[model samples]
Target: MKGRTTAWLRKKAKRGFRGYPIATVAFYGPTGDFATKVVASIFPDEGSDPAAMERWFTQDTDVRTDAEIGEQVIAFVRGHAALSIVVTDGIIGCPHEEGIDYPDGTSCPKCPNWAGRDRWTGERVH
Candidate 1:
């Protein structure tokens, strides 16, 4: 049940671009090893930005393995009647938002592990 929801979402994403109303899913955390937050957005069409977005957070559990959170994510996508789903394969970055959570040019004080590292690859950056 833990991995099942994640698998289902991934399966939907693997179906490729079916049509309009695409759902995008991304995970974030303090470190690349554990996802503490998940953000899901719905794009109505190719040229349009996301019309709807939702975020879930967990401090003690990984959002990837949280059954309830996964269910909510599935429901959100379905509720939007999304024809396509795109999910990130790994944690992309910190859960905090730049400019909103911290200054734009400064590293997130709450997520030092992600500082000076590539968000997608989690590799140290020069």
Candidate 2:
């Protein structure tokens, strides 16, 4: 069941845009290979910012495959009555927020693996 919840979530997302109260799911980690953090944001309506945002983190396991975390994420989206769910296909970037976790102009000190890498493609950038 490690991947069951993730599969379910992705399946839901594949249904396409249904309506308002959309939930966006994104994963982050030190490197693009393993997701240590997951962020879920809820938008109550179109052209509006997320009204609620929640984050889950794991130190010893990938959050993507963690059954408990996956359940919680599913529950959170359901609780918000989200009509649409959008999940990122893969890890997007470092788990650390640049301005919040480190100096805005500098790379994350804790995640050198993501430095100079494109978050979307995971490719080295010039």
Candidate 3:
């Protein structure tokens, strides 16, 4: 599965991706303790199939050591924020403004208001 996904990513790269996208899963314990983490970042040389990746994530699985912990993490993200996790609790004045679009409609990566940066902390997002 990893190889297949990687190949897809390579294909995408050949086509072109503005930035390398990735997926990370953070697990927690039954009591809601942060347990472990997994990141599928080593993609193939080119591009990837977004739909396939989405299916892989949304599909039911028991790969985690603690199923309950996984469930809790999923629920927390779903309830507290959008599917994209943005840690804003401790950042000053966080929950920063949205990313600004360039005159051509693309996001301005150099903009101070870029969504990828934690406005309050000036920290780079993962």
Candidate 4:
């Protein structure tokens, strides 16, 4: 135990960073090789999964505000044991702008403004 981490562990311990299940960062090892591993406990800020947000924005019709959208997304994600998703375009319908033909919430014969959604994928980028 002359130069072991466990022996050092038994000594006075300094608080380490706290974000568990975090993305692994590469670092040079004692053998001069790059490696990755999760060796500590760090409380995550509950990562913002864009995929989950996409799912919620597509499925749930009750969410309107960006805050509500994000909250519902996190809730839905936490409910599932695991989930994986990918959207081709991160931005959906172009918001009302100069050249875009996106339906403004005003004259939408299909849906409401706050509930403004992409009818195809049902993702509200507007």
RMSD of each: 1.1, 1.2, 14.6, 19.9
**Can you write out model 3's per-residue Cα lDDT over 1-126, one digit (the tens) per residue?**
124432332343355433333322322111122222222222222365432121112223322434444444444333432223222112232111225323443434433343455434546674
> Which digits, one per residue and each the tens of the lDDT, describe model 1 over residues 27-115?
99898888999999999998898999999999999899899999999999999999999999889999999999999999999999988
Ranking by TM-score: 1, 2, 4, 3
- Write one digit per residue (lDDT tens) for candidate 2, span 45-122: 989999999999999888888899999999999999999999998999999997899999999999998889898998
Native RMSD of candidate 2 (Å)? 1.2
TM-score for each of the candidates:
0.96, 0.95, 0.21, 0.22
lDDT of 4 by residue, 86-120 (tens): 21212222222223334443532322332455424
Tell how far residue 62 is off in model 1, in angstroms. Answer: 0.3
Best to worst by lDDT, what's the order?
1, 2, 3, 4
lDDT of each: 0.92, 0.91, 0.31, 0.28
Clashes of each: 0, 0, 13, 5
The deviation in Å at residue 111 for candidate 1 is 0.9
Which portions of model 4 miss their true places by more than 4 Å?
Answer: 1-65, 91-108, 111-126
User: Candidate 1 — worst ten consecutive residues by lDDT sum?
Assistant: 1-10
